[model samples]
Target: MTNGSPSESAISPGKPGQSTAVHVRDVTMDFGNGALAVSNASFELETGKFLTILGPSGSGKTTLLRMIAGFETPTSGEITVNGKPVDSAPPHRRSIGMVFQKLALFPHMTAAENIAFPLKMRRFNPKTIPGRVDEFLDLVKLGGYGNRRINELSGGQQQRVAIARALVFKPELLLLDEPLAALDVKLREEMQLEFRRIQHELGVTTINVTHDQREALVVSDDIIVMDGGRIQQHAKPVDLYRAPDNAFVAGFLGVASFINGHAVPGGLASGENFLSGTHAGDFADGTAVRGAVRAEQIRIAAEGGQLTACDTRLTGTVRDTIFEGERQLYVVATEEIPGITFRIYHHDPESFGLFEIGTRVMIGWNARDMKIFESRAS
Candidate 1:
């Protein structure tokens, strides 16, 4: 048992017949004052799958994750772990491991000691503890770092130690609460890959919560986007990015620009300029709608060139341009769509000189690239 291999029974504890690792049914959390932190959230995680809950601050992403970890009870509905209801179970009673934003490794303890603490607390056989600690240190790629104190290791190394501690006990499920949020951009990105590698190696079902969209896209098998205490959309990373369910999802996933207009037969129209794009919903003609487009989706050309193949075309004056190393951001001001500035990301700076501040440019995009959503503005 100490060789870092989990017994079959502990890996799928509680229910031997269940295929689902975690099930949340109509769970809701209320925090007094008629405030609801999580509203009617429901989802299921298959065994050994990784799920990330993404949202902005105060969007209930953390609240929902805590409910699954048994740290917070739902005001309504129920949660089940490995086919057994755990709504009433305490955090220690459930077979789950958690890595917090603060690593939480004891500075006084060595890396090996930190990993061994959990095994000791869980009452693993004392004779097997040393080998288990060694196994986890190697599992996290910290084989020779067992003797180093928490402060002696780098930020990323400390993270590895925290992860080793969480998994050394071989819990059936793992919960990560923005564990990489504090690291620098490069280190955070690197740790994302580390997490995937370790999770695949162990096949542990994981639920991570973070406000970083890029982190969610990089590390999650499935992403659940939450806002205002409600689930907006849930899908795989690629599908969620390509086909967002609404304007909120579209705006949140990337750098987006929205233009308000009335829905026409094939797209939305702002005055004489008809922006052709794909649309959904059953609104009669002349219904107010917004067309959402990513910055990279639009093509920019000097002057008004021949863009006969493009579904939508317009000429705008370059109001501002930002040089961002590999790519340049151009803010185009147009009279066709008043009050909405189009953002175009030009990756090939050689082909297009940083358009002067007042230079006029032509821009176009295929109809399919633009996503239309019904506007709730009254």
Candidate 2:
């Protein structure tokens, strides 16, 4: 695992009723026998903002979320919710609403009953429970679903019930742990939008953990990418995708292609070809480096086609082609790099000719679209 610095320090605790929604400072978790799950993680979340912790399995995203939810205590460091330390507070006293990967709805309860469970458990006014249930049903667009049993609803409806249940009691913070992971792709996308809508409507400060990149991008105001027990990069969705801090974040976030080369004055060089790119890291001349480019950023054309606008150009043979519905992916074997193949995406397949296997073509991209980083396995 690569070591990474914490993205940001916790925001200073604010005056009464003005604290950051969540603040985790230098939090580390280690099991016995050197099983370290998370290391030196720190970030601040503002009120009414949505943050997604994105990473692959075993990346410690879930463990971090569990710590915030008070399910597990951090081995070191401090966690604060609304300016109060919560390391020793039990889950029920933390005023947090959670939606787990599994719906966890009571099988025998009706949808309305499910939503009302939290309120009843919290000892809300008995006379107000029915009206509150109706209001929450409307919030999740599940009005009139109170009479239907859990088994009678569709999967998406069941999901709505779970969300409504979590929010009905009006917790100060919401934590979602891969709630849409089990849904079908289409439903999951739809629910991603629904989650955004509900969050905005209620103005809830939320933290969600997911391995799905698309879900994180679609739903988050900011994203924190975790890997190998460390915080990698924390930024808005576009910045995280376009300006990754390292090779791991770039590879994890999108369909990235890398070319190994040594650092030149402003870019990288592979054999006789000099590739122009942009970078933010300190790389001395002659240092081993790699150029990273997204597949969609490169444009491909037949030989002799005009590419005067591109900063870097290369000639290659189309080694493979994949026809997705909206775009076509081409794998090009370039002469400049002996064993490496460049993956390029053509979005307007209907407008451009599809270069079949073995067809000679030219590929080009602007230097700004490619980023140079220290060579390492992503």
Candidate 3:
């Protein structure tokens, strides 16, 4: 939105005392091309909470974010900010702050000037703008570097400036559209923590959209997983990891290995081995089903004995061993499950090359670690 002709209010346009910061109700976006970009999406963000919408490309995460940002109007639903509908409100007219992948700082403007731009555009008290700029500069930890031009600053510093600019006016809701996508791995991880720090410090309700699962897990109080224009699951990070509602969510959120099988008397039957595990719904005998077990939950045992009181056991040949600094990954192929290969993590920092390739090892996991879900194919 153009900075000109926007609202002049410094505080959030949203009414106060409402627990929800943003409310999206049965929102859908159809671009008139016979395909819906977002389908019947609904969620609520509490005051001062951090949420991330995570999915791969074409999953409609960005489209969902754009709808909330007032850039695109939903075809079938209403969006409310602090309990008021903002479907017809212009972007700038809403009390929301946004940071995108591109920093979008004016090259000719200094950092301090960049922070003050929003204040000037919103027509804040001219005398108070300078102090406000300094306050935000310090808030983002760029206190003394405000005089540097955009080109003179480092990439991370430029990011800090962008954040300062967005938060200088203290908009109640913050939208981050993959703001850290351009940084290197180390810097991106650092900024993820920085984002959490700043959000906790200010208690500004935030919603971020990204394809990065680690970022979503690291910085969000809650997460919504989307696929094929639909929301698959929405839950807190730990619960989303520990207990996924469906197979797609289980495979997407963690390193889970899959074994296709059919439902039996009490569990699932894959090849010659009987599997036992947790499941959300009832599965009739002879129904098509698939079992999932996380990498961390599987452990390597001795050839004749089990590891740590596991209920389900299997003997497999170690096919590949991968070292990843803090942990070792052992890939096992068991004859009992002909087509399925299991990846197990050994987080013992000192256990480098603990198992050699071409070695026979017994791997086992507790019954609870293996989750059974109805086959998506069925």
| Poorly placed runs, candidate 2 (over 4 Å) | 1-19, 33-35, 376-378
What digit string (tens of lDDT, one per residue) describes model 2 on residues 1-378?
111111121212333224588999999999765767999999999877899999999999999999998888899998988878875566666678999889899998999989889888888888878887887788788888899999999999999999988887778788999999999999999999999998877777899999999999999999999998899999999999989998789889988789888888767898888999886499788888878899999989997888889988888899999999899999998877779888888998998878889999999989898898887654
**How do these models rank on TM-score, best leading?**
1, 2, 3
Candidate 1's C-alpha lDDT? 0.87
lDDT of 3 by residue, 52-93 (tens): 999998999999988898888899998887877875567777
Residue 48 error, candidate 1, Å: 1.0
All candidates: CA RMSD in angstroms?
Answer: 2.3, 7.0, 4.2
Report the poorest 10 consecutive residues by lDDT, candidate 1.
Answer: 1-10
How far out, in Å, is residue 32 in model 3? 3.6
Candidate 2 collision pairs: none
| Candidate 1 lDDT over residue span 1-378, tens digit each | 325354332564434334788899999999895869999999998888889999999999999988888888899999888878875566676678999989888999999999999888889899989988887888889999999988999999999999999998888889999999899999999999999988877778899999999999998999999998999899999999998888888999988889889999889988888999889667788988888999999988888677767888888899999998789999998767778899889997877667889998898999998998888754
Let me know the TM-score candidate 2 reaches against the reference structure: 0.93
Determine the C-alpha RMSD for candidate 2 after optimal superposition of all C-alphas.
7.0
Quick one: RMSD of model 1?
2.3
Residue-pair clashes per candidate: 0, 0, 0
